[model samples]
Target: MIRVAIDAMGGDLGPRIAFQATQKILAAFADVEVRFYFDPQHFTVPEGASSNRFTSVSCSEHVASTESVDRALFKRCDATIFRALTDLAGEQVDVVVTFGNTAAMVALTRYIVGLLRPKLYPALIREMRPAPLKCLVDLGANVHCPADMLTGFALLGSAYLEARSDDAANVALLNVGVETSKGSSVIKDCYQMLSARSWPAFSGFAEGFELFDGGKNVIVCDGMVGNAVLKASEGLFAFLLSQLSQHSMDTTAVEKLVRAENRHGACLVGVKGNLVKGHGRSDEKAMVGAIEYGIDIARTNLSKKIEQKLIQQGVL
Candidate 1:
């Protein structure tokens, strides 16, 4: 059985979305069990929802989305994210899924669960839209990354795709233009670093429009640019839906195609165990999607595969 620990006290919607998502996950997957960490003073389980597969643990503290990473790590050591990660480190849980403070979650994961390599940091990797087989790295983990960090993200992203598909990943660096001379010095340095490797197929640089064109299997970028592109795509999806509705067009197909791409949670790679981070403002549907995504990661043993890949590539 796969055990998933969730930070119920996190996210903008509070514990309600967590509870609702838990119920949905419980009904959907019999092989998966859920454990929620929440403050007893703030949340209570709905009547008659208890089961052997679903359990709740009482936590006394919560981490706000605006909480600084340093404050969360030092002052709010007993927060829900901290408790969940501690359990993860202790091997009590197979995976952790939370819609909490992104910075706090990444920082606490590194401090608690530990990283595969001390010099390498964790990154958020998610499958890109219109092409679920392709992925983007550094969704929002580290906003300012150096050239070596970007190269590390590329390695992590390639390993992630390989873990899921059991095939070598074709990687590309995201830039303003496809030419190597278009981006900043950091991008150029990363390109040179990746070009030196032969394991993961490097396909030069890629423009933003190439994300959905199926030109590459993995696109690498820093957290700032990745987060900006992610938010922009979400806004564009919403605008498209609204326009379609006004035109009295059938929006079911459009929603079905874009919802999975935009709403699924991102996997925090380079960490010791499986950790999935949902958006801070995630609704019940998005929360459920994140939990399911965590289950997939645990079942596949993704973290171990990534570590092995890194070692094979001499990046460790």
Candidate 2:
């Protein structure tokens, strides 16, 4: 049985979408199970969610307010999210999925499971995109990072790429150009280190415009830069939508379902648990997609894959 530990309190849709998604998932997969860590009777399943596959656990407390790394580990003991995960222990579930505060998950998971000892601040991000298909790291967990952390991001990104695409060695560091010396000194140094290293198959620096090229799998950068890039991409898309805002565009109710799968978020990779942080302004479709993504991730045992790669490359 594959168990998905969900932070029922997280995300904009809260329990409604979660309940629906849980129902949809259970209906779709027999082995999939959803354990909602929400306030007891906080909400009800939409219509047909009371199946044998879905169960709800009441969490008296909630995740910390801030996105600090400390909050993830220091969450209130009574918090539903933490309680559900605590019960998960080692074998009950596969991954923990959350659309809540990003930093809180990181902090709490690290505190509970400890960092990847060798790669202390391993890059925990999501790359399941629609158009660009970019594996972006540090969407907002850590504002500041060093070279090794960035390199670790590359490794994590490579692991994701190897699992998702045919282009495994196509991983690149986010840069202004494909040159060895590009961007800030820190970035340039990381570029050189990765370009020289044999691990993760670094493909060299990736320019800003080349991010959406679809050939590159991994794009490593600091959270500040990554966040800026994400905003810029969203702004560009919105601008394009405005420019191409058609009066008779494909805005059918069916389109809403497709848009949901285009979720923007990343999963926490380094920690033992399976936690994904959805974009702050996620909709019902995105929320459902996130839940589905959690299911796929849990079934794939992605964390174990990364561990194997890290061990093979001596990163562990």
Candidate 3:
């Protein structure tokens, strides 16, 4: 059975959305179990959430988005978010899902379960496009990273895609231009290193305009650039979709941006355990989507595969 620990005190809705979503998930999956952690003083289990597969644990605090990482780590260490992750670290659960403060979740998970060899922190992975599917790494995890760290991100991104398919992805660095001298020193250094590597079919560079052009399967970059690119794409798509309401423009692509799948959260790759961070304003559907994604990730055993791949590539 796959067990998932959820930080019920997370997101904007607190335990309400978490509890309701848990009920939806329990109704859909038979072999899954959930453990919800919440602030006992403010949260109560919602109706229809009572089931043998569900477990509720009371926590003393909730990590707020505005809270500093240090404060959350030291003062609110016993917060529902941390408690849920602690359960994951102890092997009591298969995965941990949260809509809590992104910084807190990342910091605590790294401090607790530790990084998966060579990773300074986890990289968030998200799917891109309608037909020729691909994954984008480091969506917003590390704003600034070194060359070698970017290399590790590439390896983690490759392993994630490899777990789902046999085809080797054509990886490319996201940059201002395809020219080698276009980006900053860090990006140029990363480009040089990736170009020298043999694995993952390094496909050179990709610009923002070429994200969905179907030339590259995986795009790699520092979190600063990657986050900007992702948010811009999401925003642009939302804008275009809103304008074409009367003309019957296909909103499938735009829907993919607004849908629960991407909004649910991004996986914190490079960690020993499965950890997903939902959007801060995640609703019931987004919460359920995150848990469902966690279940799929558990079945994939993604972290183990990532470790083995890193070791095999001598990157570990």
Candidate 4:
């Protein structure tokens, strides 16, 4: 059985969404156990939570603070990630899912769970946007990177999206242009070097806008560019939503629900521990997906694939 740690106190629709998602996961997956940790802002697990054959942990103290989180992630010394991981260390849990602050999530995972350095290093926020939907690594996972590190990102994105996108061979390297002679000497050299490699068949270069509109699957780039592209895509997604009111076209419920779910989740890649990042404004659907995504990571053996590719890229 896989144990999942969920942060109950997170996102705009906290308590309710977290609760509903937890219920859905537990009901749908019998082999998976859930552990919820929340402050007063989010509801404690219902009365039946404890005896329902699952584990639930609660902390009345609020562990999430917003003001400082934008610049830095929430403190995980004794709250949020740390709390869940404490239980994990004691063999009380296997994976952690939360819609809290991304920085905090990154920091906690890096500090507490520990990541492989030099080879297995780098954390990435991967997602699929509208249009073609590609997975861009190091979104908020790291702020700094090198060519070697970016190559590692390439391998990771490939391993992850290949499975998620139905083995779509649409991987691309994000750069200033689609041309072979684009970007700095570093990127050009990397591209030339990569053109002759044996891994996920390279899909060539992709521009910032092409990162989404095009049907690229995996986009391997530095954390800085990846993060900027992420923010840009997020801004556009929001902008499209805000302008939705101006449109007179009839919208389907599934379309609306899917767009809603997209806002609140990003994958936490590269860790010995199981962790997922969700939107600060996540609702029940988003939180629930985070939990299930973690389960998929575990069940699909994502870590193992990452290990194999990391070795291929000479990162391991």
Assess each prediction's global lDDT (C-alpha) against the native: 0.87, 0.68, 0.80, 0.67
Pairs that clash in candidate 4: 73-104, 119-315
What TM-score against the true fold does each predicted structure earn? 0.95, 0.85, 0.90, 0.78
Pairs in steric clash, model 2 = 59-80, 61-79, 72-108, 73-107, 73-108, 96-274, 126-266
Candidate 1 lDDT tens digits, 195-254 = 998867899899888777765879999998998998898779889999999999999999
RMSD of each candidate?
A: 1.6, 3.4, 2.6, 4.1
* Model 1: colliding residue pairs: none
What is candidate 2's lDDT per residue for 101-168, written digit by digit as tens? 76666666766655655455755576635444567786777778888788777777776666555555
Model 3 ranges off by over 4 Å: 246-263
As for lDDT, the candidate ahead, 2 or 3, is: 3
Could you tally the backbone clashes for each prediction?
Answer: 0, 7, 0, 2
| lDDT of candidate model 1 versus the reference | 0.87
**What's the lDDT for residue 101 in model 2?**
70
How much is 256 displaced in model 4, in angstroms? 7.0
Candidate structures ordered by lDDT, highest first: 1, 3, 2, 4
**Candidate 4 lDDT tens digits, 1-316:** 8778887665677666787888898899998887777765446557766745466666645446363444233343446556886665455677777776666666666666666554555566567652344677777666666666666677667766654556655667788788776687767766765666677677778877765566666787776777777767677756666577468544455357556445345666666555677766766766777787788776655655666656665656
Segments in model 2 whose C-alpha atoms lie over 4 Å from true places: 41-50, 64-75, 128-133, 246-264
Give RMSD (Å) of candidate 4 vs. truth.
4.1
